[model samples]
Target: MKKMPVALMLAATVFAGVATYTVPAQAATNSVVKPELDEGMVKLEVYFSSYPPNNYSDENTGFNGWLVGVTPLPNGQYKGTYYGYMY
Candidate 1:
């Protein structure tokens, strides 16, 4: 009976060690690239608690915008970008 407890404790310690060793490697693999804008263009970034909304009304305001990308952040928010060219 005592052997069973000792074996379980050993297994947990080994698992914890493996988890700590691999976390940094996993984080390094996921890197975000910076967005680039070209001449005669503009970039706008916004954050949302959920998915971004459609920009159909932007045309009426003369922006003619569209979603460039949407990245989900670690803090339960979304980071989105809009790229548009003005008239």
Candidate 2:
């Protein structure tokens, strides 16, 4: 599997600015139950705790899915994530 780019990870995780991420007062929480990987692919596991419990799976199932893809830049100085562009 390809390793994640340091810069891209930094930009996304480190220097990334934050905005209010609103969630419904209900719904089931997420535990990243499973991931189906393709050949040469990998994943970064993340955890979520819902305020109302089981939010993602229960009520927010549609708008609340998961991030899946990451690709390193040509020069290897940066990386991009499919999740970054997605909600």
Candidate 3:
């Protein structure tokens, strides 16, 4: 009966270790807009929270969705994210 408890504890530890070591692969959230520039320029980046609209209406423009822009600081030291909408 005591052996059963020890086996359970060992199984739990193994399971926890496996869970900690495994990481699920996920798609990147943002992508660099300009990677060619190396110095003195705040790199621009853009990312979409959701897939842009595929269909367009007469009154509404297509590709209306959440758009995020990473703007470089004027000092060229840091970057900031600006959220905007389309349509």
Q: Assess candidate 2 and give its lDDT.
A: 0.35
The candidate maximizing TM-score is: 1
lDDT of 2 by residue, 1-87 (tens): 999899888777644444223443232232333456545443332333312222122233223333442233355332212121112
RMSD of 1: 11.8
Model 3 root-mean-square deviation = 12.2
lDDT tens digits, residue span 1-87, model 1 = 445688899999999999888754213322244346678877766688976653412555566555656778999997767776666
Q: Over the stretch 1-87, how does candidate 3's per-residue lDDT look in tens digits? A: 345688899999999999976862222233343234334323222333443222222234222222233333445432323222333
Each model's C-alpha lDDT?
A: 0.64, 0.35, 0.38
Top of the candidates by lDDT:
1
* TM-score versus the correct structure, for each prediction: 0.42, 0.19, 0.25
- Residue 85 shift from truth in candidate 3, angstroms: 41
In the predicted model 3, the residue pairs found to clash are: none
Which 10 consecutive positions of candidate 3 have the poorest summed lDDT?
61-70
How many collisions between residues are there in candidate 1? 0
RMSD of 2: 18.7
Positional deviation of 17 in candidate 2, in angstroms? 37
